[model samples]
Target: MTTKKYSRLKNSFICFIATTLLILNGCKTNPPNAPDDTTDLGKVFISANVLGAVIWLNGNDTGKITPDTIEAKTGMHEISLTKDLYYKSTENVEIIKDTTIDLHVTMEEILDIGKVYVTSNISGATIFLDDEDTGKLTPDTIATNSGVHQIRLQRPFYQDLSKEVTIIRDSLITLNFDLVEESLQTTVLLEDFANVSCNPCVASNQIIESLTKYTYGPEKLVAIKYPTNFPSPNDPFYLANSEDCDARMLYYNISFAPTTIVDGILYPISTDSVSVKSAIDQRLQKNPQFRIHVSDNIIGSTYFTTVTIKVENGSGINFSDLVLHTVLTETDIEFATPPGSNGETKFFDVMRVMMPSNAGESLDGISQIEEEVFNRQTEISTSWVTNKLHTIAFIQNVVTSEIYQAGSTIE
Candidate 1:
């Protein structure tokens, strides 16, 4: 009786132990939903703009890291940051346990530099400096100070841009600007180009919309809609400007519209960031040299601004047909489908020509000649959110239609 009882007892005890182990193993697999006690409480900073950004740590939102640091747990946490037009970046970060880590980063740019300088293809753009109120373009030397500066250019019909150009101490940068009318910096222009009613164009437009939104997002990026002489009749923006498109095409040697010159300078090899960054890095390596002065004022509801396109040491220059057109635009105008237009239409810089169609009045004898003026009437007309107005002035080659110098003013 003693031996049998002992064996039964042992079997029962073994079974009980096995059940307990199974339960413990299950618990390990699905741990309690609480911050681990052994988790590191160190710091890992976020790299974001002063504007705003949403940061995530370990699949949990660690709140925003605006212009500064983020308090995060240490050692290998998942990090995600998001904003408009920027590519959402996710990374498994390696933070030292209980240590402060600096993760300074420049978020990917979805919008073109909201500020830029443009030169006309033909006309000589006038530059008005705030310090001077009215000054010459080629003192070749307009003095600027540290901090923010206002510069402006004006012309009739074309949208005008007044922008803040920042200057740093002892930063000698020179920018000789050329502006463009009918900006080709938007995705719409590419759609207009690649989606012509012909082989590969229609499909190309669809591809452009999806890809551009994916890459650039919205609000930060836009594609100019450039209709051309290729018989894309359905496109309302389409115009019989073969000479304009052709000359620009030759200068930049661009094969199509899906192509654009970012920051008024370089062209992205294939509209991808990695490809685009290569061009950006090359330019950024060199500090900004010349400062373009742009500013504006309200005159009896007809806002008037002065655009001063100056060059540092700009003397004895002869680039044929450098035309200037000031364009005043109201962005964010939503449209389902414009009458006599194709595709979902969203217009930016809808050309309200303050000047004649030729870009200027004097067709002849306008060369090396410095200043010009163009005016327009600005009254709220459902163009933008009431009181939310922006002016963008671009300079393009009338002969080539290539945009070179551009700047904008927003109020």
Candidate 2:
């Protein structure tokens, strides 16, 4: 063998080695259709029979509604679709890297119904379902479609209550609400027609005052003494407001002084404390159908009185021919000498004036769950003490002669 033959053989072996290295490098490079292992994400196309169903991925809201595409990490994921009035649907899916998967869900409609027993701490509350009045009261069962619903309870003189409840199919749910009552108290009115000149009025007035001030207090009873012209026509209280005094005296058909009227019922003329107390106790047992609030303030020489009347509940009582009477009275009147024939030196709750006449303002249309406000202003009389002035208001049925409620500014 020659030296030239050896050199050519060595060069051929080196060229073959270089060709093999180039082929190996080309095989190591990734192909265009192959997936890159570095990225751990996949695309999911979600759709539902109900187009607006919310999509949840791995128990987290994907912030996307159905019929949309979402990107998620490559792993086993739980997909759920939720829509109102539809049963929730869930499915488990496996996602491959750089792969796209399609998911479709069939939503089921909620056709089953359930019963809810509605009740409250106080009965007679009207039931409302989803803002619609069901025309049903508490302690009644209402059939409703299975779903999430808003329940509301409403009643007169109570704060309305509301709650969100989920009704399960073929199940019964019991809901009870604690109702809050508006602050209200029934007050009795005692109208006593008396004169300072009558000797019997002194004893009657003392008995009435003792009951109204101490025995019953202002919460239970209110008394107004209207000066009468019977025994003494020259009575100073009668002279102050003769028109109202005379009108009230004739309305009740009073024949003499010291006559008492409890509510609108005429009572026998008696100075006995036991008789007066018995009459008042009868009226106190009646529940209040209306709430009366009276307030007064003095501005300049004018006395302003405001009366607010609210119907607390529906008692099925006829409200027709109802009248609201507001009276201005002077209390704790003291004098150095008796003003009339009687030797009485002190008078309390003397009728000063009746606003808008004794006929009273008509409350013809007042009804349940309603409020009426009246503002009346009267000129302050120079003879009456300003600090001792008080206002009293009451609601009465003129036809039946029944007083429903009464209020005063005594406190």
Give the winner by TM-score: 2
Residue 330 miss distance in model 2 (angstroms): 0.5
Each prediction's Cα lDDT score?
Answer: 0.42, 0.78
Relative to the true structure, candidate 1 has a C-alpha RMSD (angstroms) of 28.0
lDDT of 1 by residue, 1-411 (tens): 242244346556543553344334331221111111244456676776535766666544444544455554455677777554354567677877567776654667543223223334334445554432333332234444455666654433234445557755555545444444432222111212332443443343444445435654432233333333232333332232323333333343333334434434445543454544454344334332222233554322244556555333324323455555554434444556542323434444332223223243232343234533444434322222323344445555455444444455532
Provide TM-scores for the models: 0.35, 0.56
> What lDDT score goes with residue 241 in model 1?
32
Query: 1-411, model 2: which lDDT tens digit per residue?
Result: 132244335546543553354234332232211221244678889898889888877554555798998776688988888775566799999887898999999999878978799999988788998875566999898877788999999765577899999988899999989999767777999999898889999899999889989999887899899887656666777666666776686576555667788888747445888878988998999889888877676643467888888887756766668899999988999988898877999999988877866889988776566567899978765455677989989998888788889999896
Off by over 4 Å in 2: 1-182, 266-269
> Going through the candidates in order, what is the number of backbone clashes in each?
84, 0
Error of 2 at 73 (Å): 92
Clashing pairs in 2: none
